[model samples]
Target: MKVLLKGTSLLLLILAGTVMGCKSPENASNFPKRPNILFAIADDQSFPHAGAYGFAEIKTPAFDKVAKDGVLFNNAFVAAPQCSPSRAAILTGKNIWQLEEAGTHASSFPKKLNVFTDMLEDAGYQLGYTGKAWGPGNWKIAGWDRNPVGPAYNEKELTTVPSTGINKRDYFGNFSHFLEKRATGKPFFFWYGGHEPHRVYEPGSGAKAGKRFKNVQLPGFLPDDSVTRNDVIDYAFEIEYFDAHLLKMLKLLEEKGELANTVVVVTADNGMPFPYAKANLQEYGTHVPLAISWPDQIKSSKKVDDLVSMIDLAPTFLEIAGIKSAPVMTGQSIVPVLFSKGGENTSKRNYVLTGRERHTHARPDNLGYPARAIRTKEYLYVKNYKPERWPVGDPVPPNDENNKRAQTEGFKTLFPGYHDIDGSPSKTFMMKHQHEESVNRLFKNAFEKRPEAQLFDIQNDPECLYDLSGNTEYSDICADLRNKLDQELTKQGDPRMFGSDIFDSYPRYSPMRNFQGFNARGQYNPAYAD
Candidate 1:
């Protein structure tokens, strides 16, 4: 065995030819010794939105193909509802709470944390990524020389695009470039991080593309109106765009004779960028679509209903590559689930936990709405540590002059205050109609303060429209879930258990917004100063 340095910081190990013997299923004589890993992650997408999930309005033939070829996971949740922290959880194989600064949104990734990609690189797998990877935050600020995911292959750009909001970067072209640059006979780990279906969609693009508002299914948390429906349709268009690239990548792999030897896992960073989702701990916010396929190892056309967390992905990848997970990683590997032939599988989780701290500069002093949740097969119990703080954000004053400026420069740029929800046509429409009798309840659900403890029977109320915490009949169920959540969070060393403000003390790296009383002095966190 030999070790070599690549570039300035990356320590690439060049193992002897004998390294080829390190395979997951050594007995499979026809399979490649070490399978290549192709991980495709969409920017902001929810579960049941893919064609494989019976969402006919959303065209996702590529995702459907993967589901048909492998396992389709019915219950997959992220550690955080926001992209940065959720992505960090996937890379580190730890829940957002288990991570310190890395746990919060738009915060620096601590250098000491070990990511599976780094471990894969050290074990002789060629590592690279294209499009969005492990950020919306600064990895370099925390002492990394490059993006935490891997090297970038985002040079290729599309000349003509379908929508203005869609990224022009040719995701498929860049993937081809990565394949061209790979070292011979080395198993590769490539991240196709598509920055699609997020927010700021081209208004009415769905209508122009021949999509009807009638076909769009509005979630119960949102208003059942044309404006909101169109917004969802536009979101679907971007999702289809993301899937198109995945199809191209799959075709390229097949042409290269690498499809059968590759492990393909497709999912999203978080849910759709919407008011009651995205940064929130609701079902759509945390639960995401997941499909995994490996011709040589995994069985085909199976649907798994077991609870799975995004953190488990890192451990699974490491196990497949014949590498061990980091000691700090708390997630259990799903390799057993993957290898299961069918019914009565060994992989089953009692519950999966999710939480969040800070999203954007939505409140004064950059304070985040702190909350933790526990989701079992039947119910979801959430405990808002600070129920006093507004869940979405402090409301923007109606008479503020910034409202006019926001119309021109956008709500996000001028900070019209409900900054947790991304600036979009749907948000604008909802705010305009918040005073109306028909839309008032939906608006309040999306943006309002809440009780500390809330419980929902997710199976019955998938929309989470009714909180069962206050109901006497469900009191026992709520109490049981709360006790379970507290015990596990305490055992896992969550700072929130000790009433620590550690998450809020982490410095934010993205563009800051000015809310009421948000001054320069309040913006700085000296504890995290360089």
Candidate 2:
């Protein structure tokens, strides 16, 4: 009798592991003993961008090879659209809402929540990380000795980079150093977090590198112009740069005779850093690419269409290690789907839940654009708690008073207006051409206010160009989805259901600026203090 644990205690999880009938992964013999786990995460990349997904603009040979050798997931999503919360969810195997401070961007991680890394370490797996890990937030305040992912291995540095914005962390070199330092004969779990395709990309780098303007595909929400095309192409260039390092790392593993035994999971933290994509609860925001290769266990040439979440990764890792997941985890392991010899959609999940709290210091008083969503194969339903607020951010620039205060307080980055939307060439173009008739709608779609309830038929409108929530024809579908979302959120104890402002109460550890008394002029008001 397989028992599905939900909202159970840690004691129960431990007891179940030792119990005769309830032994963890009752069929543990199916998996090879102690396979190495190689988790490679790109910073801000969306779905269908990699070569495996048939997007020619971005070339990711390593990701494509992993997909060809193992499973290519068509419907993989992050727990939150923002990086911090999304990474927190991936580490904890729980929804962002379940984590208090960690649910918001640049907030301190609570010490009570245990990460899978510690569990894996306890299980005698050698652990380490290179490049970016579970942060942009401070882990020290929570008394963590190191990053939640594990000890760092970022001493290696690259002498030169293709672009000005790309990090010179020497990711592959650092991974080689990590392998050299690890204990002999022990299975390793490594995190290769690549900070690429995020923002501040080199201008015309893609076109200069022989990428054509005609090949670039713009999303429906963005303007179809030279600026947008150039910006997207530049983003693709960075992704390829990240992939090059991944290819080198894979080769290193293969040379060491560990590629076949290593469970290589390649994915992104969130979507592309474009307006209506990164921080928003839209399709491109939460949806990301995923490819996992484990030649010793998983079957090759399989494309899985089942819905999977970043939160599910932790439990999946634990299950593969023959250890039970922590009871606090709300996410179910995808081991069944990973090891399945069946058709594409073998998993039982009908939908995936995604939400966001604070992303950047975009709104006044560090308040986040609170929203939750339920995504199914055909439709996506979103419930925005604060519909009156700007979805992207305040259109107005920061007041001189706030700017001066930030400088006086010694903050690194200035309060750039609309901070939630990453500062990029595309964003600059939209702001400059907001008055043009063709660009006006696109700007509004990205920068303006949104409705409380939004429903999109993803099958037909994958770009989410139309909302069916107000359409009388889809009233029943909308109602049913809303009820389902509400029920699940309530079960998961989402505080927003009862009109609680708990997410806002969490202390933001990052830089902050105040925008007071501007909402009357169609901007932010200083109602809540940061």
Candidate 3:
């Protein structure tokens, strides 16, 4: 190798071939050989929402540039649709069912589940994150000395956000701080988890931020009223705000001459926080946008159509960093596809499994709506374990008088108890227009109790409006997909399949509200109603 440095010590080390080959303390690959990593995750955004995906309402130049420079995955998914478990799967490379308490939303995380961030830190990589690393759950209870995602870097704050809904944290400023504090010559890893486009947006903020309601696209399940359209625009505005911070961070990397070598991955934890999305395990819920850039190795401006999961992220990082992935990780690395013929359907993956347990403490007895699913290129099969229970929880608690539980605990449940979908103008409009026949699909698709199994031809009906589970024409296809989903769940040892109570046993760490449940015959079930 040519001696690129002028110092005598550098010349001596290069002349001594043995010294040139000597490994770092972490038994790491050469520091320059391993690229600096920046993983940015947006909270509560979904697929087909970014500008790179051709949505004009949302401006995401930073995410689009990453796609322009490297690979954009069209079929990427998360292990679970909710936040904590989805993020856990991304960091640990395992499904939520495989993780104990970490699997449940707002539940205590068990100490046994190790994460990739700690692995990178142990490998002598400076690791840190800003804004929403991991959850409504308490990680401290799991015996973690710090947040499992990384050490926090959210000390820096902004005077105000663009709107009332936008987060005030200085995401790029904190990332810059992380870079400034990093060890010299050491490859660094930073997680920029942006809390944007989630909920509680300033009313009409999207219109205020130059978003056009006419440009908004409404899913088949959502009513296309003016209120809903305006809400969608507001969501777009927050997404753009998140993208703006990402652009600044990317510019910093380019200014520092680290853009080409640094690996950049941009994605979201789950679907948009709207009715029939986010908490539900439909196509709109699990199918999220993913874009990656590793300019040093992969060619520019290509797209991949293979089925992939966020769980694949940890393994991919380990693979690219020249480190062996732990055996416990179930996800496969995308490195092979990145180095191969970059064409649609050229990737080896055929199917990606996704599922969920509890999301919020929204039901009576703190019960959860459990579901599992498998998505193939042609179809999506969903298996709901509890069909008897309300999927999104009861729309309203029982009307009661002089009942302390109803008075004190009915705050979140009194108006609309389907606590899974976020409360917003879209949701409120849908609920208000439930009586209208044309707009009632939103209510039926989102709030109604469902069958034990559902089959949707994702090729033709990505909206999942037509359920083919009972149709004779699709029986064989449904059977094959159901079998595959069960087989994977069995292999992963999911408690929902085996009827384990460990999921319900994990105590919720977030705020609780007691709810009254009705009997099968419509009478209040006093056992829980009190």
Predicted structure with the largest TM-score when compared to the true one: 2
lDDT score, candidate 3, position 4 = 19
Tens-digit lDDT track of model 1 for 130-242: 99999888788679998989999999999999999999999999999998999998899999999999877999998889889898878888888898899999999999999
Q: Which TM-score value belongs to model 3?
A: 0.90
List TM-score per model, in order: 0.90, 0.91, 0.90
Q: CA lDDT of each candidate? A: 0.82, 0.82, 0.79
Encode model 2's per-residue lDDT on 1-530: one tens digit a residue. 11112333323333322111222433343465889999999999988789998898888999999998898899999999988899999998888877767887888787777788998999999998998899888888788989999999999999998878799999999999999998899999999999998777889888887888778777888899888898889899999998999999899999999999999999999999998889988898999999999987775568888998998898889888877634446777888788777465666799999999877766665667999999999999999999988787766555666666766765434445777899988888888899999989878878888899999999999888788899999999999999999988777767676456667666666666555422121122233311
- Per-residue lDDT of candidate 3, residues 1-530 (tens digit): 11112344333323432121212222223335888899999998889889899887788999999999988888999999999999988888888877766787877556667677877878778898999998878888668888888899998999987788888999999999999998898888899999987888899998987778987887777877788888889888899999999999999999999988899999999999898889889998999999999888766667888899998998788767877534446777777666666675645678999888878766666777889999998998999998998888766634533134545644333445677777787777877788899777668888889999999889899888888899999899988888888877766666566555446556666655555532121111233220
Q: Which is the better candidate, 1 or 2, if ranked by TM-score?
A: 2
True-vs-predicted CA distance for residue 334, candidate 1, Å: 0.8
In model 2, the runs with Cα more than 4 Å from the true position are 1-30, 342-344, 397-416, 517-530
Give the lDDT of residue 19 in candidate 2.
Answer: 18
User: What lDDT, from 0 to 1, does candidate 3 have?
Assistant: 0.79
